[model samples]
Target: MRGLHIVGGNQLTGTVTAHGAKNAVLPILAATVLCKHSTIVNCPDLSDVAVSCHILQHLGYRVQRQQSTLTIAREEEGCRDVPPEWMRAMRSSILFLGGMLARCGRITLCPPGGCALGGRPIDLHLSALRQMGAVITEEGDTLRCTAPGGLHGAAVQLPYPSVGATENLLIAAAGTPAETKIIGAAAEPEIIDLIAYLQSCGAFIEYQPGGNLLVQGRRELPGCLHRVLPDRIEAATYLAAAAITGGKITVHANPAHLAAPLAVLRRMGCSITAEENAISLAAPERLQGAGSVVTLPYPGFPTDLQAIFMALATAAEGYTTFTETVFPRRWAHVEELRRMGADITVAGSHAVVRGAPLSGAALTCTDLRAGAAVALAALAAEGESTVTAISHIERGYADFVPTLRTLGAEITLTEV
Candidate 1:
């Protein structure tokens, strides 16, 4: 296990260029298999994206990674399809099953792995593929999918706008032979990024005036190069960390893209100044507690930032409520934070946090964003802190300890 050794009571102050969206890059990488020609992608160094590339390679795609760039082309022997062993390693591995099944007419995948925040079932993905005329079977831990003669697009209405389900459907629909329309589509920036990549590859897709998407499938996709958008969630985490520790940091990314989280920061009395592509935040010596925050989908307070904001709430002078609507059981980190001297109580999906001075303790990361929250709280705490099982953090955050250390934080990493 790898743990981050953080000496607390230091302010993070520096300029940090945000990386590509871990969420956006994964599904986009899965979409590369739809192309007969090589596809080039410029992305940041994120472990999850790299792991997705490895899964693709195991499926027999010729993949090359140089720094932040990835070039992927079909192998001479074609792909043998992604196996169940590699699929169980990461949640995004499920994404390739749809694309590969649509194009290759067969695919098999195991249940994917990631942080245990809540029950993230792939039933929506399976149902959508079934509606598109695919034969799907479940045998114990493996999912076997076959879409003979390729897939035909069908109208899919997601019970909930799951980002993974939406991307799976979109990628599968892009390679199919019929027109596919998705109702109540997730309008997140990540979804838009995937749509842009599909459009670049000759898929005719349009976002209707209402909340629906229309995709016209094509026979083959052209070789294309694309650059990923900067990670908004990472930007929010850093911004909240700066506010929690009473420091100033300029994030060089699209600031307007962070309106929701930035609004929450401003409400918490953090002084925020913004430019076109960069935003600088300076926390007040004393933070004023914003009473309540409810996490929602796109254009709302993101669930991804709920953990970070909970940490920020700890530095406030009063009480704050963090509510999770997307994942009912996502407050697993509340108990971990309480162990570190934070006054917090978890009630189902909501957490009631009372502002208190936090002291160091040995903490374990319950999930990916939760680990980031742990770091945020530790930076504002009174003494040294050790965060264990940080593989979840490493999956989404690239060079995390170094990034924090560059901002005047005292942190080191040890493998134990």
Candidate 2:
């Protein structure tokens, strides 16, 4: 395994540009199967991206990558069953269900796997598909689905704004025979980006004012080129890293997509300067703790950044409470942070953090975002620290260690 050895007490400075959004690119890559030819530019080189490309290749797509650009062409007949091993490596692999089913009348694949962020059931996606005239059967770890009569348009409403579920339905509905309306759809910027890409491919998609999405199915979609939006989660992570170390950093990203997190940091006494495509944050010598934060759907605080914010709150002046309503058992990093002298108490999905100076200690990352949280804590601690399971961080962040190094962080990767 590989680990990060970090020397604390360094103020991060300089500027960095955000990479393409992982959440956006994964589904967009899957949607490429809907067209005869497609090109995705500004794609991040992430493990999850590689896995998605491999899945596409297995399905007989002519996939080619040059640097950050990916060109996919459907040249041969795609496979109907995805290998069990490939599906088990990535949760996003489940997204292929909608596009594959739309193209081929049937698909068989095992349950997808990813980070252990609690119970993330795919029941919503399955139910929505069944509502759209799909027959699904579960056999042990595999799921076999068939739409013998082909799929048709239907009205589907989500109990919650699940991003993955919304993307799956949107891709499926785009290839349907008629108009499909989705209620309570996830209105995240990534979802909007996917819709824009689908529209470029001749699919008619509209976002109404009240969290409704309308997808007008077309007889065929043509190949198109698209550039992904900048990753807001990555931008937020770097911003929080700068704040925890009491540094100044300018991030090149879309400021409009990061309104909620940036507002929270500004309330925590960070001097924030906003521009059209860039944001600069100058952290105070000591940060002040903000009030409680509740992770909600789009336009609200994201659950993805909750862990990193918790790490920042550990060193603030007062107590900060974080309530995660999106995912259960997201506090897997609380114990690890406590090992480094952080005062944290977890009760179910809620955690109360008491600001206290932290000292460096050995830590193990439990998941992707939790890895980032520990790295932030180590950067702000008083001594040297070692963090293992860095592979999780690499799954999302592109050039993570190198980017932090550019910001003046004394961090290095070592294999053990």
Candidate 3:
């Protein structure tokens, strides 16, 4: 286990560049399994990506990482069953099912694992696959899927806009025998990026209004290099850290594809400036409270960023309520923040945070983004704060400590 120790009340200053989207990069890597030749991806080196690479390697794919570039090449026959124990470490392991079924017509894997935030059901994933003409059944903890004579795409509608389910359908439909029309699709930037990469692999796809997407399946796909876009969640996390610490910091390589989080921060009295390729944030000397924000799909307040935003709202002038409609249990960090002297209360899917002075205290991270929230809160606290069990944080953020240190934050990490 590893822990981060932070000396609070230090105004973070300097410039930090946002890395590639962890959300986008993971699915893009999973899509590589559909390629016949080696695929090269240039992006940040995050632990989740490393775990995705490990999953690919377990499927007999050879992966080489040089700095930010990852070269993935398949060297063996199709793997029917994905390693079960390996699946426990990463939730994105479920992403392999779609590609494996598309390429080899069958895939067996244990249940995926990630943050225990809520009940993340794969029902949408199985339903969409079945709609695409794949037969699926559960064998204990393992899910076995087979599509003999390849899948034939059809019109499928999701009850909710699930990012993981949408991505799984995209990968499965990319190689099926029939064209797949996905209604009520998840239009998150990561989903769009995955569709774009699928198009690069010779899959035809188009976006319609109201988050509907149509993917055309074909017989063959050719591999190509893909450069993942900057991580909007990571960028928002950094901006929130800046706001919470009353610091002035600039995040380079932030994509304008996301505007909701930036807009919310601007409303919170943070000075936000944007150019063609860069987004900068200068924290106000005194942070003002934002009334309310509801987490929604893309182009709206992102559920992924709600935790970090709560940390920024802690020092506000009044109370702010964050309603997370996407996932009820997403507020795992609320209790952790309360441990650091924050005034917060969670009611069902909503959390009310009253602005207060945060004092340094020991806190434990519950999930990936929750870890980031506590880290941001620690930056603004009055004394020393120790964040224990930071292994979850490393799964997403790339070089978080170094990035914060470069921004003049008094933060250090010790391996246990």
Among these predictions, the greatest TM-score belongs to 2
Q: Candidate 2 lDDT, tens digit per residue, 1-416?
A: 99999999999998989999999999999888788899999999999999999998888888999999999998777455889888988899999999888878799998898888888999999999998889999999879999988888899999899999999999998877679999999989999999999999988898887899989976467869999999999999999999999999999999999999998899899999999999999999899897898898988999999999999999899989999999967888899999999999889988899999999999998989999999999999999999999989988999999999989999999996
TM-score of each model, in listed order: 0.97, 0.99, 0.97
TM-score of 2: 0.99
lDDT of each structure?
0.85, 0.92, 0.85
Highest lDDT against the true fold, candidate: 2
Which portions of model 1 miss their true places by more than 4 Å? 38-41
The worst-scoring run of ten residues by lDDT in candidate 2 lies at 73-82
The window of 10 residues in a row where model 1 has the poorest summed lDDT is: 76-85
Instruction: Candidate 3: give the clashing pairs.
Output: none
Predicted candidate 3 versus true structure: per-residue lDDT over 261-286, tens digit per residue:
88778888998889887788898888
For candidate 1, the clash count comes to: 0
